[model samples]
Target: MARNFAHGNYSHTQKKARNTGRTARDQTRRTLSQNFMVDRHAVDLMVKAAAPEGLVLEPGSGEGALTLALAEAGARVVGYEIDPRLAGQLAARTRNDPRIDVIRGDFTAARAPREPFAVVGNIPYSVTSKIVDWCLRAPDLTSATLLTQREYARKRAGDYGRWSLVTVESWPWFSWRLGDTIGRESFRPVPSVDSAILLLRRRPEPLIRGRRSYQELVELGFGGVGGSVRASLRTRYQGVDAALAAAGVPRDAVVGYVHPDQWITLWERLCG
Candidate 1:
C-alpha cells in the first residue's frame, strides 16, 4: 500500500507517506552514510519548504522517500544515487514519471547547472559538510532544505554560540534555519541519532556586492582558532582595529562570537 499517485490529495499523500514509514525501514549503509527517511511528515515539509522553483538537486535518494514527494509536488527533480543498485531501482520506479531524472553518480563531484535551482535531501551524515559547501557554491541556488543530524543542524542554525567556517563564509548570502526534528524511530533501521531539517535561503539582494572577497575576509578571520577576531585579522590586513571599530566588534571579541552582520559591516568598512 503506497501513495495513490493520482490526485496527490492530502489524505492520499499522508496515507502514502504513512505506509512508506511503516513498511520501508531498511538498514543504513555505513559507507554511504545512508539513513533512509521513512517519515512522511518530514518528507512533505522538506518538499514544501524548498519547493522547486525549477530543477531540484537531490542527493542520496534512498528508497525514493523524499524523491516521490518531490515529484508529486510538481518539481523537476534530478536525484543522484551513488549506489548502483539504488540508482537502477530508482530509475526503474520513476521510469514513467517525466518530472524526475535519476542520475547515478557522486553528486558532490557533479557540476551544478548554471540555471536556478534548489537542493533538498535527507543527507548522508558523513558528507553533510561537503554537500552543503557544494550547494553554497552553486551559481544559481535559490534555497536548500536538508535533513541533517540534529546536532549538526542546531550548530549550523546557531542554536548556540557556535558557527562553522562554511556557515560564516555563507552568512552574507544565505540564511540558515532549523526545521522540524525526526525521531530515530522514524527510519526503518532506526539510527542511533535523531535527525533535524535545515533550511537555507539565499538573500534576494546580497548584503554585500562582492562574494568571493567577502568570503575570503570571513575565512581569514574565522580561520584563526586560538585568537580574538581583531588579533586574527591584524597581520592579514592593515587597519584591523579600524574595521573592528566600524563593525562595533570589541577588540578582544572571540572570532566565533562575532555575528554575521558584524562581519559584513567590518568587511564593508575595510574593503568597500
Candidate 2:
C-alpha cells in the first residue's frame, strides 16, 4: 500500500520534474548549437538566396528540411550531418530521392568536389567560422549561402561599413553580401540571436594578380602599426601616400574603414 502525498507537495514535485526535463532538452540543443530553421518562409528565402543548381553541399542538414527544399529547387544536394540519429532519419527519408545524398560526418573534414558546386545550409553557429573557412578554401566552389548569426553576416558582408580582415583578404575571389534576416522565432528552440543569410559568390576572374603578394600587402595594411592604415602601409611599401590618394583612402582612415575595392586600387598603385 502506497501513502498519498499532499496535493500541494505532489504539484510542486511534478513542476520540478517538468522543469528539469525542459532544462535538459534546452541544454542538449545548446550544446549541439542546433537551432534548426522551422519556418517555411525562411527556408524559401534561403533557397532563393542560394539559387542552388547543379551540385550543392549543405552543412548541418537537420531533419532534411533545407535538404529537401534544395532538392525541390532542382539542386543535387550532398548534405552532411554529424548527429547520427538525425543523419539516419534524413537518409531514410530521402532514400527514394535521387537528388539528395545524406552523409553522416563532419562537414569540415569533407573534401571539396572536383566539379563546381554551391554550399547552402543553416549551419551550426558554433562552427560557423570553420564552415566558412572550408567554403573559402574550396577550389571548385561557385557560391555559398549560409544562415549565420546576424552579427556574423553583417560583419562578413561589411554591412556595418567596417570590413573584417578575412573579408578584406577574400574580397578578390569572393563577393560577400548580407541577405534576408530570419527572426529568432523562426527556429525551433529559438536561438538567443536572430539569423541572417550570408551570400558569397566567387568572381569569374580574380580582381588582382599575385594572390600571395596581395594578401601580404593587405596584412601589412591591417597591422595597425602606426595607427592609421596609411601609416601602417607606409612601413613596408614606398609611395603609400600616392597609393592612398589613388585609392581614395583618407589619410587618417583605419584599415576597417577602407573598402575592398580601394584595397585593390592601392595594390595596383603601389605594387602593380
Model 1 scores a C-alpha lDDT of 0.79
**Pick by lDDT: which candidate is best?**
2
Supply candidate 2's per-residue lDDT for 69. 95
- Candidate 2 yields a Cα-based lDDT of 0.87
Please list all clashing residue pairs in model 1, or write none if there are none: 25-188
Span of ten consecutive residues with least summed lDDT in model 2: 1-10
Instruction: Report lDDT per candidate.
Output: 0.79, 0.87
Tens digit of lDDT per residue, candidate 1, span 10-41?
A: 22211222334443222225445777877788
Q: How many residue pairs clash per model? A: 1, 0
Residue pairs clashing in model 2 are: none
Q: Which sections of candidate 2 miss by over 4 Å?
A: 1-26
